[model samples]
Target: MTEQKRYAILPLIAIGLVGGLLSGLFGIGGGVIIVPALVLLLVMPQRLAAGTSVAAILPAAVVGAISYAVQGNVDWTAGILLAVGIVIGSQVGALLLSKLPVGFLQWLFLGFLLVVIVSLWFVVPQRDSEISITVLTGAMLAVTGFLTGILSGLIGVGGGIIVVPVLMFFFGANDLVAKGTSLVMMIPGSLSGTLANWRRKNVDLRAAAAVGLAASAASPLGTIIAGTLAPSMSNILFSIFLVLIFTQMLVRLIRAKKN
Candidate 1:
């Protein structure tokens, strides 16, 4: 490997170690962690970081989904619907990255994350609840996935930030089911977005591989931990995580403003 590539390896692994645990535990693609780490630590441009994060997310999403599936936490039918919508929507989101300004996307991302954090505090998580999908509910699920896919592509999140909350708050799914299904839906969306980003020359393959592999390796452990946590506890932990990230981003924005 080149000297520059070698230097990037350790950072990628460190970021992935934390991201993978979050991905498996929360059913997110861990892009929230990966993107910022890339942008703030590696000094990468926002769009490129977003694209690389999506690419790195795919493997972790797949592993996390499998871990949940094995425990029968996944709602396959709902997840499939979400996946179909996200696959198409992710392409559109990827297109937008090239068109929109980076500062706009960054502000938009932080705004959205703040909303998610607030919602998590108010929404009670169900551990044994399940989704009852009718035709209308199915349609809504698809729509949710479509919107989340756009966010994932644009913000480099795995779409779980919205999907998990929506499933729990709107669809009456338990936290485990929601998280598992979120991971399942992310697989296609992440794959589709990564390809689109790659075609646009936005992906950094070496970094993605380094992060993706490490995240995948660590996700199973997180899956096991998720199984042990109560739904209420999980929500609280996730909320705390979001709060820290929100603070980090806020500080970054202030620094940028000052500069």
Candidate 2:
């Protein structure tokens, strides 16, 4: 590689490493980190950054998912069912994105996040033993997946925030399992989305590749730590994470309005 290219690639790797850590720690796809880093550090446009971020998420998801699976935290059937629904719902979300007003969607998302935050904060999380995959459970997971996918397509997030809480509250999954299942569900959708972005020439392939490789290497460490944390602690941490995300999004939306 050229000298300048090597220097540029270093930052992308750093971004990926951090994103990967968050991904493993919280079951996110890490676009939240990748998108902003590409935009600010690489001076990429927002659309291109979003597309490239999707590509960067692929490896992190894979590594994190495997790590969680090894720890017995992943529910394969739930993840698969969610993935199927996400694929279908993403298309609907993309269609809705253009039809809905920007402010309306932004408000809606923020409100939903707020509700989730409140729910996670106050509710006593379910025990791990309570988790089971019945037909009805699978159906509920699919519905959650659809909502997750719609939010992903509409707001460009991985929807782990939504998924984790839903799994914990409604499906009786523990925090680690909820995070793991969410990570597993992200793999297929991220791959598909990345390919679409590549087809549209929206990805910075070189930078994204660097990010993905580095993220894959670092993600397992995060999963290890997450597995060790107390369930109550994990729930609190997850709730706090959602608050930060919500605050950032809300600020950005307000600034956009002022502009």
Task: Highest lDDT: give the candidate number.
Answer: 1
How many clashing pairs does model 1 include? 0
Model 2: residue 56 alpha-carbon error in angstroms: 1.2
lDDT of 1 by residue, 154-186 (tens): 888889877987888889999999999999999
lDDT of 2 at 26: 84
Per-residue lDDT tens digits for candidate 2, residues 4-118, read: 2322878888998998898999888887777767777878766667666767777888999999998888888889999987776665555554455546876888898788888
Query: What's model 1's overall lDDT?
Result: 0.88
Report residue 186 deviation for candidate 1 (angstroms).
0.7
CA lDDT for candidate 2 = 0.76
